[model samples]
Target: MIEENRFPVIETDRLNLRQVTKDDAESILAYLSDQDVMKHYGLEPFDSIDDALDEIAWYQAIFEKKTGIRWGITLKEQGRIIGSCGFLNIVSEHRRSEIGFELSKEYWGNGMASEALESVITYGFEQLNLQRVQALIEPPNISSQRLVERKGFIREGLLRNYEFTCGKFDDLLMYSLLKQDYEKMSYST
Candidate 1:
């Protein structure tokens, strides 16, 4: 079984992956409500600040229950939350999980997502003993698809009409990396 309580924080070279909390409402609102960030993700603009606050509370509750791990990605130099990243839909028995992430528009093209995902993928394999890690990217999200590919995740296939978002069904592309592949890359580097 995965021990969710054993690890709380993961540090990357330029970012700190810390647990999401209700107090993060303000910071999360800064990006979560941005229309640019939510556009291709099939989410509507946050109608009110209260919506962001409630979302943070919901994430905190999920963290407390050991259902998933969410992190506020804070830049080390400024100590400001520029993004969020984490594992979702963890299935311990199957030794697999889905990964999700988002960054403030300002941080785009800076390789922050790639850096953070590398660190988190390492943690999932080495610390959590997961056998596989996967990312589901909407087809039009070319940036995210490139990020996953750059991380050495192979394109598995497409899940047709896999999710309903932005008023209609959307297709998803699945990409995955195995524990063995990660280990090989680690040793090679």
Candidate 2:
């Protein structure tokens, strides 16, 4: 069952996924303001620390509403956040939620995203008792596409013009990992 009163902190070999606090606003703004990093993030690059504060507020709101949880990804050696990842749009009745994540460009290609994703997926299926975790990726975001595929998320189909963001309609590819599939992959590995 999902924890309703406390945020869960997940630790991996090299990373710590913890609750995002107001103090993290500056770090969050640093990456969220980067044009390259925000390219596929749907929203435009953040302009001020207020944007980051708003994001942190959203994180808190989602948790309070019991609709989602997002973790700030920090290095084990350095406690500052370098990225964030988690499940959103959770529907307990349906046992499903959407998974999303983003990392600082400096940390790209370091396998951190994959590591974090594995932990989050495990928590979703095992701890949250979710049956399905889905991801929506833009067609041009090849790295994200590969990341989810490597984690055994099957391509469901294209969501044509599904989101109108940054002044344009964008197509998103829908992918999902079922609990059964996760268990199979777990046993195989």
Candidate 1 pairs with clashing backbones: none
As a TM-score, model 1 comes out at 0.92
Q: Encode model 1's per-residue lDDT on 1-189: one tens digit a residue.
A: 246565477777788888766667778888988998887766787777798778777667656665567778998887677788877777887989888889999999988888888888887888778898999999889999988887789999999999998789999999999988888775223
In Å, residue 65's CA in model 2 sits off its true spot by 0.3
Error of 1 at 17 (Å): 1.1
Per-model TM values vs. the true structure: 0.92, 0.97
**Which of the numbered candidates is closest to the native, going by highest lDDT?**
2
Model 2: lowest-lDDT 10 consecutive positions: 180-189
Top TM-score: which candidate number? Answer: 2
Candidate 2's C-alpha lDDT? 0.94
Least lDDT summed over 10 consecutive residues: which range in candidate 1? 1-10
